[model samples]
Target: MKIKKILVDSLQEAIDITKSTYGDKATIMSTKIVKAKKWLFFSTNKLEVTIGIADSEDFQKEFSKEKELYSEIENIKSTLKDVVEVVKSTKQEQKTPPPITQVQPQNNEDFSLRAMNLATKLINAGVDQDIARKILEDSCGFDITIGRLDLKYEDDYQSLIEGLSKNISLKAINFSKNILSILALVGPTGVGKTTTIAKLAYMYKSQGFRTGVITLDSYRTGAVQQLQSYVSLLEMPLRVADTPTRLRECVGELSSLDIIFIDTAGRSQYDSVRLKELKHYLENVPSLEIALTVSTTTDERIILDSARRFSELGISSIIFTKLDETLYPGCVLNACIKANLPVSFLTFGQKVPNDIELANYENLANILLRGLS
Candidate 1:
């Protein structure tokens, strides 16, 4: 098997290039729009498409084996590097003599320095300053014994960091007694709510559940069509409801289905009139779980504000999208912690059923510490 990343001006060009290079048998792995630097002060946008092809059965087996071995080796290397860093730090600390002080240096200056360093690390990772400070205060004690910033307190510092990273809340979907569940997604424009709904529909359908999708996003151009593309491919039913009455009717019709997902038009969080209209549609719906979808690549302030304003719609959980577009994952933790909501799902790329995952606490913590790059 062979893989190649092709850059082109448009999706059509990418498709043509892949077909010309690898023939019809090639599989498109992912597609993303990125800015390419054409000059020092200017940049142009281009489409990046990763495509793969399998030459033969033997080659596929060889490729799979080599990929697995390479992944294992990389994991081993990362673990060894971390171990080496800890060993080196310990050795350096032993070699240097501790500064002599009558009272063991449990002063405000030492505590302030340590807190500032931790806050700086968090802020550099895209976390809000207030959120970072709150995390530090919540995770570490203010006792004099905890004020030392030396080798003797190295383990304590490490534990404090780990505890702070675990502050994110994670929630899982609950399938009701009759095997019928209703989930609605709401968010701002271009945050991938439609695509995420498609992904969730595909995931549930693949699990042998009778799934149905309904969209109330008829206002957005091509929104229904985008979702229809996926539903049509999966042979699932899709209903477009433009009003509360239509939505209720659609829900009634899909009652026999095991799982039903509702997609809504993206509205600005500041648009209270439209938000109230949306609430009217969902307020009476029984057992409906609303998930507020937000992009991880967005600014931390916007994320927090979106979470706050969307809470008016009674958002039950958060669904973070576009994780693959950003290197800093700390915004996810910051948003969730600030909103006091649990994360339900994470969408990383454009692939249906492939890029979405159930939120895992430890996996997200690792990503926050070591970015996707």
Candidate 2:
């Protein structure tokens, strides 16, 4: 096999380059956006794509044969070692009678060992050490006999993680049957609030719901234009509410629609004034659900801090974006657990609708344990 790293402007360009250089059989190992210095105090970002190509057919066959031969040799060595161990055990057993009490000591030792191992696995999987330790310690009084330990330990671990995840708060937009349901997305700058709103607009529109979008993000350049493009493509109503009164009026006008998603301007979490202003926009709005959109690519601490700060706006649910861009996707689990917020959606790429997925406990568990495909 051969591996190469190529820097390109986009993911598509990286794929094209990989295909051209390594043929269609090549596989992409990873893709990340990296910043490079072009000059002093000036930098540009590029996609760093790692790809691999398989060896030739003849070479693969030779490797397979050698692997099988090595496996057989290792198996013979293992069998011989097992036989010697058994012989020594038999001699010992004959020399001295077997211990009358084995189960209690063995069970206690196994219990401690398994608990430590489980905690280590969680930590290795990017769980916060405190969270992982607490989880294991909470289960200390549970039965850890060898029989129970052998009974689907992996499934138990997954269940344990899932249960902890469920403790996090998750709230979805409560769409009314007769009245329009209003959803407002609020988050820090560059967390993809606008893009996430577009994805949700597309999703609801495709479901045949009367969807409309209103943006309170006129502060950012091109924010309205970007959302306008999506609303135009989806053929849904678009409104720009630059002020709290305008937002209320816009909500009143779009109230007839089945779903109305309001996009708020991204403010720094540290900026309490701006955050309060953002909150003021929706404080008077009745029956509105606010979804806090955040990037999964950021540090777990940042994510938690963002959630805490944004909770001032009464975040109903969390929408994690850029899951595809992060190496430690387990941050999703950590963030959800730490913030005690339920996830509304997960967006992995730039594509609208297609890149977004509804959050589920099973799917999150799989990603936390196995990672993204």
Cα TM-score per model: 0.62, 0.64
Q: Per-residue CA lDDT of candidate 1, range 81-140, in tens?
A: 999999999989867554423223233364446555665666676777666655555444
Instruction: List candidate 2 segments past 4 Å from native.
Output: 1-121, 133-166
Candidate that scores best on lDDT: 1
Q: Give the clash count for model 2.
A: 4
Name the 10 consecutive residues with the lowest summed lDDT in model 2: 144-153
**Location of the lowest summed lDDT over 10 successive residues in candidate 1:** 99-108
Query: For every candidate structure, what is the RMSD over all alpha carbons to the true structure, in angstroms?
Result: 39.5, 37.1
lDDT of 2 by residue, 80-179 (tens): 9999999999988777543322323223243455666665666776777766655454434334334322212355456455445535455555565557
